[model samples]
Target: MKISELYVYPIKSLRPTKITEGKLTKLGFRYDRRFMLLKVIPGENENGSGPTLKNMHIPEYPEMGLFQTEIEEAKGESEGDTSRLIVTYNPPSSSDTKDNTESSDSEDSQARRLEIPLEPETATLKPFTVTMHSSPTTGYDMGSRYNDWFSACFGYPVVLAYLGTNTRSVLGTLAPAKRNNESWWRIWKQELVLPSNGHGNKMLNQWLVPFSLGYLVLNAVSWCHGRIENGTSSPAVAIGVTALALTVLWTVVNILVNRRHEARIGFADCAPFLVISQTSVDDVSGRLDGGVEVDLTKFRPNVVVEGAEVAFEEDFWAELAVGSNGNAGAGKDSKVKLLLTGNCVRCQSLNVDFSTGKMGTGEAGSVLKKLMKDRRVDRGARFSPVFGRYSFLGGEGIGERIRVGDEVVVLRKGEEYTVTGKSASEAWNVILTTGY
Candidate 1:
């Protein structure tokens, strides 16, 4: 099978973009999760040591987004090649990665950090202020697949995408049998409250023999029926009436079993793959000093490789790393572990703004929890449609953000897996084996 889509998110809680191809490294996407929002009033963890300002970048700060970010030491440096961890936020702090930094770059960024005085970011970045930096490739597709879409659609950044091939099968298998047993009634207060399943039928067709051919045949059949009944009666009308009438009586049963399909690998010819972060001599300081947020609406992620894609993230989050393979953390393997399972339907009640990146009230989150009482999605945790910083799947601490130059490989089923960024070791740590 070939990777068909990729996504990434730039801001901590903004919308996401879709991308066709991307560069992969151990930390994750090159530009993914570069900035994040730190809720200063955190209800539960607010009082915990007051979050010592060091080593952390808080979105609440105003002047933080003043510079650009990149990973100078991400990969490909020879013995004499100079590659240092570099962050160039303000112009003055900008320099070659070969320089001996640490105190130098910080001092420079701090000096030029005075533009947005009214904002949280400041000139000194004192009181333990932290900064974030990332590679340019990281910003590739930080829009299309993020939770911000849902926020605009429903006032919460909730988005979900499935290998149309995979989700359709899962829903078909689960829907037909369940619907036949009146399962829709269980999910909703009444069967009448359900939204009409239009495109949903498009999915069930995938479960049939020769899905592509079946869909073609279905279309052909609809055409012929209408042609024959033209002038006298519209067969399209007849079929539509029939389908509705049938639904009222016998609920269609789901008989498909062990459905399987693979995406054509030809789509990705000059594409990128999930990478390994084994190259230890890195330019860690290359990314921290970036400013200015782009309108993610410009990017789209349709072709993703391994597990890392730009413009993919949930609301209120930046990076998400599922395993320690080539996608996140450190790894020498060519494979990647997914930070999340199936697409997460977000809590609109927990909706976070897309353009402004403002988080909504806690009550919205509560509403989401109530709505998820029976669904497979996680209720207590937050999630984004695209990939990002805080991984909600692990319930807050599930996973950390993924960045560029991270390594990863294709995910397979029934194989031993190790999640990235976390210390847990077990077969279950495998995010998802089969698309099902």
Candidate 2:
């Protein structure tokens, strides 16, 4: 398969900016999700209190998907290598009636825009705590201007933070605790914190503690209290058990099955790269109603490839070596290898239309339901339907660059076996022996 398109989301949940070429790093594409929005939890003090912010995902606020961002790389000899991040807000202004000139000049039709230097050398980076995916971490606030722009777009109090020093291991990537300990549970979310120097905060030290056991008791009492008081649904016990089991299984599989590779990922979901196929989008479009057009954009994939024989063929691929002109083994210095980490599960976020921020409900043009009918085949993640594959840059290709039209050559294919087990230990053995 050859790459047909490329995309980078400088901020998570925001609209993607298409590019002809992109540099691949351990943290996915360069500039992808390097910045993010965090909704300020109301009525809370953030003074060293581990940042009173709840991360925003597209499903919770579909309007965020309407905001688009583009990168303007510095030009000329004096400008150096810095790139500016330009954001454009799409408002509810358009022209479907007569008087096209008037509609074009109308304020509603005009898009609000702003630009910020992505990696400014002259600016000072102030350290502040923030949360993402329920993981408490530190980031540098991008001043009040960027925060204000996002607040105006979302009509809510929010902040824009750069992932300056935040470090994260993939969810379920670490080995679970063999024994349950209340102390570990109390500080389960502490694993998300970035290691620091001697200087520290008393409030942060009081809250962030070491988590080395059992399940991820992310923020424990505080997290649950906030969610419950805010009228959010309490998590089921099954979800915790499943997550713990999967983490253990994944740890074992990594040790016994694939021990040589190192996994480095950032805030781009489960892995560093997500790949989708044009054939898969075509297949989904055919299944949906005639009026509903299912494009590759809805999936928000980083790399889009073409020439797959059938839909979901990417599931069996274990590794891919990317090279120019669809030739992975063309030369030694020009190849970038990627290891397929796991299958990406679908969620209600896919129901949100990219062009329009509206979302479909229930069975009415629901992409989730259509995917569940035939794509629920991931052994560990049987609860949700699988679509694209999550992967990581591997071997000497950690800093390599891949462009549109590059060939994606599969290196390994996984063995076929059904996961059968009632307990977590049994499931771990099944996963390692069967080679999922």
Candidate 3:
């Protein structure tokens, strides 16, 4: 198997920016969701009276899928630390009514392009806070011009926010639990922080919560040195050597597992990257009304693989490695390593048509129902049908570029490995032990 397609979404919930060669970062694919839209909750604020912000992703507003965005990075660094992001709003017009296609000459003409600075000056802007999943992080208000642009487009009181800092950290459950109890739980120091997307299951949250006693005691020494949050009593747990070691191990595993992808993420729902087999998509499409032709982009995967022998065959891949140009590298430069985190559970977002911005298409639950006939692997999300595996790129090839046609190698196969969601620590062990 090989990578058949690669994509990046510069902004969350908007259109995908397709690219053959992609660079991986600690947060995610470079510029993939560094910016996001938020629904301005009407209330009182610092400006005497203003609105608070809450995340409005594809879940809350499907119309966001209608907007297309392109990032034009400056050719040289001397031009200043900024890039131009062009956003094109695809409004529903009589011309778009004829077909369900995403782009056309008519729509292109009608599409309004809004050019915004990549690195906007936040010196005069107020520090706006928003919650992603459930993690609270601060973002700079992009001014009224941006707010007006998105508000007019999405037909709501929306504000654009940029990730000024890597505020929110990846969930402990998504990545492996840190070893030797070094308090590797949070990246941000907030009073009452929660895991993103309500991943706080009763079992896992007990050990992973930022303020839990187990965490406090493990790094008691660091907290005593005055590492507390906002100068509050809650001290910041100093990251330990064990935590760094685990990270290094995770990176090494990612490099050897699949050299095509490295460990990096930026605001993606679950993991840094998601991979789906093209054959699986073909299977789902074949069953959908025979001629409806549901595009794979609806699934919003970073990487899509073609030529799998059977549908959902990717489930057995524990540690996957992919080589460039069908040529395998000897030490580490040859391939990209990817560690299978868990199965991606589908949500209502899949039902919305990316091209039409309409919901409840005939193909919405049709493919899911067919997949549920046998392909349910995640016991925690048993009611949901899974179509792709959410994975993390290992650290060794952190910024390596991988493209379509990279040869895929399944370095480890774990037929018995499954994400039970009963406990993250237990699940991590299962993923670690079942692989080669």
TM-score of model 2 (CA atoms): 0.69
lDDT winner, 1 or 3: 3
Ranking by lDDT: 2, 3, 1
- Clash pairs detected, candidate 2: 177-214, 326-407
Off by over 4 Å in 1: 1-4, 37-350, 353-373, 376-411, 414-436
lDDT of 3: 0.64
Clash tally, candidates in order: 108, 2, 24
lDDT: worst 10-residue window of model 2:
173-182
Please report how far candidate 3 places residue 340 from its true position, in Å.
Answer: 1.5
Model 3 regions lying over 4 Å from their true place: 44-50, 78-82, 95-111, 121-125, 177-266, 326-335, 423-436
* Cα lDDT tens digits for candidate 2, 1-436: 7889999988888888899888877678888888878888766464655537766778777777678889887778755346788888875445774544554445643437878777644247667766434435567778787788788887888988787535564444311121112243233333334333234774565355323222344534445556556666445544454556667755764454332233434555556677888888888887777556675666879999898999878877767778866443423344477766566667767787655666765433488788888887867656667778766765456556788888777777777422212333232232221111
lDDT of 1: 0.27
lDDT of 1 by residue, 1-436 (tens): 2343455433322233344434443223433433332222323434566432211121222232332332333245451134322222332233555446546756754543321111122222322222212101111112233324322333323222111111111111111222124343332222212222233453344344344434655665575576657754467666665566545433322111111111111111111112111110011112112422222121112223233332221222212333333333432222233332222232231232232233334332132233333322222222311121111111112123333333333332212211122221111121121000
Which 10 successive residues of model 3 have the least lDDT summed? 427-436
Q: Tell me the lDDT of model 1 at 414.
A: 19
Identify the superior model by TM-score, candidate 1 or candidate 2.
2
